[model samples]
Target chain A: MHQAIAILDSGVGGLTVAKEVMRQLPQEEIVYFGDTGRAPYGPRAPDEVLKFTEQIVEYLLQFQPKMIVIACNTATAIALKHVRSQVNIPVVGVIQPGSRAAIKATKTGMIGVIGTENTVTSGAYPRALQELNPDTSVVSLACPALVPLVEKRLYRSDMARTVVSQSLQPLLNSPIDCLILGCTHYPFLAQMIAETVGPRVSIISSADETAREISTLLHHRGQLETSGKVPVHRFFCSGDPETFQAIALEWLGEQIKVSPVFWQMTRLSR
Target chain B: MHQAIAILDSGVGGLTVAKEVMRQLPQEEIVYFGDTGRAPYGPRAPDEVLKFTEQIVEYLLQFQPKMIVIACNTATAIALKHVRSQVNIPVVGVIQPGSRAAIKATKTGMIGVIGTENTVTSGAYPRALQELNPDTSVVSLACPALVPLVEKRLYRSDMARTVVSQSLQPLLNSPIDCLILGCTHYPFLAQMIAETVGPRVSIISSADETAREISTLLHHRGQLETSGKVPVHRFFCSGDPETFQAIALEWLGEQIKVSPVFWQMTRLSR
Candidate 1:
């Protein structure tokens, strides 16, 4: 079986990026693994995220995917470097892709990054942005509540908007012209953030940039799926499969069938 | 710090019960811990739920509560027995309280139980109800999607209502005069369920019964707060405090300030 591109995240947040990949690469089959069992990797220690990321990647490798996308900001922050080294396939994280997109889009060299606490604290985006443009100034904020708020489908609620406004106030105060949603889940709340920051700030979801990166990596490696076979995306979670499927349908629409893969940790070998 | 009643659940579904406790015992202070970080304990292995429940209990003990309420059906199904023996403070799980209430309300001696897959699979309620009255007939249905539906706040959505109605159709075929919302989170979806089941079947929330049990246990143990103290209700989560607080206000209302506790693992163990 030809392994498709494998995308892994701590939870449903990665679906935003996965959806983007599907839209861009309709011919490429995808396998998505969401570690919904132990999610919100934002608050966990970096070591734990590394451990969790490794487990999921190893699980996905059984499918022999051509590439892997670490579609979580927290994992990208702490585990991407280690993960890339461990996996035989090329592993891409969203942070650098998003940072590059923001740097290119920002005219004033003022960029903003918003994600979970762990992602912001890691200074992953600022470092990546600075690497691209040393003179660029980056403002990063941790919108911890935004993910759950989106999970609750409270994006349109005034209360949710108010909370987003309050959380993004500091970032809005800066002279940033481009705001990077450092976390894949953050894009779900992009409308609220965009509304709060006004129209001047361009909101860039890492999901889009990551998809582009996947396409680029696959193209460069000459590993793009060319069989013209109909793509089927498979989803698995360590938590509730039915629940994960329901949320996936809601976020990705009802057209797709996201099945649950019950993952059991058999053995962890380095 | 004066100790208050501490209630722990897998997620915000327990807020329905916490709100009732607040309403019934206005003078008593309440502290809530929702493992929104890792919720929907229904399908998880019994041992996993038990471990998570104990961890939360241990965390809540730092507040030095006189008693603990396991406001989660999955937790109650497996952990209550072990939890009771482990804690010096009386620990009351929702299952027995809910079962007793359903048995009392059912004039037809026919009862219905709706919970997560694991909860129903455990046959805990069937055994408990039978122990109370061998003549009583019980119908149990595993609502795997109910938690996610509740989490998304789509209780009233046509899709959610349709799912609930379909899942409950089997129980509707029975002669149950009273239906137990076996999972604490199920109560939030109560209004939709009540409407679906119509006016015939009485719907009982484990949260309410658990609150009542807490009141009774407190009185019996001489731990009930009698100073008419308008206690400050504090909220904590292992995940995002902002998301937890947002859901708290959404479900229970914005009348109270939901504050975040800095989560330090070592600090929690104290």
Candidate 2:
């Protein structure tokens, strides 16, 4: 009778958060939705991202989850507050968690953020970090190429290293001690980014940090699952099921079954 | 007029949390109480520890703080749930934060905890970790000598190194990736401990973790300080003011002041 934690993302990127939740909280159940069909939400308009996010959350709500997690930085930057206002359960976003972890890890107030175009344009990481501490200084860059690499399930390909290196060229000279992986998709390329940035800059992944936030919030509310039984997690994707399953299996390192879902497509292309 | 976050502890050990909160959320005002007169709650009975914690919380409540943090491991182990039941505001403890951090940092499910005698005897760290994920394996050691070194503000002395090494001798063979500084006081000697354990074991300071928890809870509730003004923090200790001031100034790396408070000295001689 345990209520699952509902997680929604733009695509397979959130499998990072989902994997962490499963590892850190083995007893808890999860219901996940990945909107892969319309992903690279990175380049989409805010209104459209927000609308898509609302639709995904509405679909997941039927699971009667105890908590809702917006596991995509693009969606979170645009829709976290809106989703929070709409839900009775607690709504968690990827931005603030990464911001908090970076604040903790950074000795210098200079923090770096690399996210999707939407998250960068929204100035969400800067806003989140500065909101907690006004003295914090942030530098942001949008790494638009990284998300599609993950969506296509090719993060391990040598081409990912090239795209990551190119996208992160501008941040190489920044004096930040800690870099926030502001896009959930960026974690798929973490090794390449880490090698590029070297050990001096600690990397803060929003995908991992969001899992901690969920654990903390659920524990405080006395909503943590303690059934001591293996939980059956369900995952859905509004796109090609085989592609989503392939990416999920690779990212999560488990043979998980994914259900295909359909959604209405709108045509205001950028 | 900003409402303060009230923090209570057995002694200056709580300053670890205070320092983190100051560094992480500079805009939030803090009101701190340290029961230095009853300094070593770690060796005291659970009932006595709980009573002392209640008295400190009672004194701190006069500020009408927005939140309460039980920053001492001993007091938190014995009094956290009781205090939560009595207060309306969110009550945070150091144990869970350290536990969560250790869980996240561990590649092996094996975790290590070093705390006060009471914290170890109470089995709070094991409970906190296993409660979240039953697969977690924890090894606990009660470093009773460590608190006195920090309390006396002698953590930098040559004798402190010998004492820390002797105390950590038992854990030398454990296969843990991350070690939890279960006692708040332990962070004062973090450098020496790190040197002793070598680089393989990652050290976690519960003091720093608790600050993250406070930030997360406040943000979720939309109660984060947005005044954008430099906050004035207040600290009180029930022991000799000079000793506490020396420790506070040294640990916090600032020329700040501490107020001396007196409590009814209970005759329950341990």
Q: Give the winner by lDDT.
A: 2
lDDT of 1 by residue, B65-181 (tens): 877888888888889889888988877778876776676567788889999998899899997676545567889989899998776566658898888888887776677898999
- What stretches of model 2 exceed 4 Å from their correct place? A263-270, B263-270
| DockQ score for model 1 | 0.01
The DockQ values of the predictions, listed in order, are 0.01, 0.86
Query: How high is each candidate's TM-score?
Result: 0.49, 0.97
lDDT of 1: 0.77
Q: How high is each candidate's interface RMSD, in Å?
A: 27.8, 0.6
lDDT string for model 2 (A1-270, tens) is 589999999888888999999988989899999888888899998999998899888888999999999999999999999998898999999999999999999998999999988899999999999999888999999888899888988799999989999999999999999999998888889999999988999999999999999999999999989889999999998789899988887778899998877543332122
Candidate 2: clashing pairs of residues: none
lDDT of 1 by residue, A111-176 (tens): 888899999899988877664445678888888888777555566678987898899878766888
Residue range B104-205, candidate 2, lDDT tens digits = 889998999999999999999999999998989999999999898888888999999999999999999999888999999998999999999989999999
The superposed Cα distance between candidate 1 and the true structure at residue B251, in angstroms, equals 59
lDDT, candidate 2, residue B215? 96
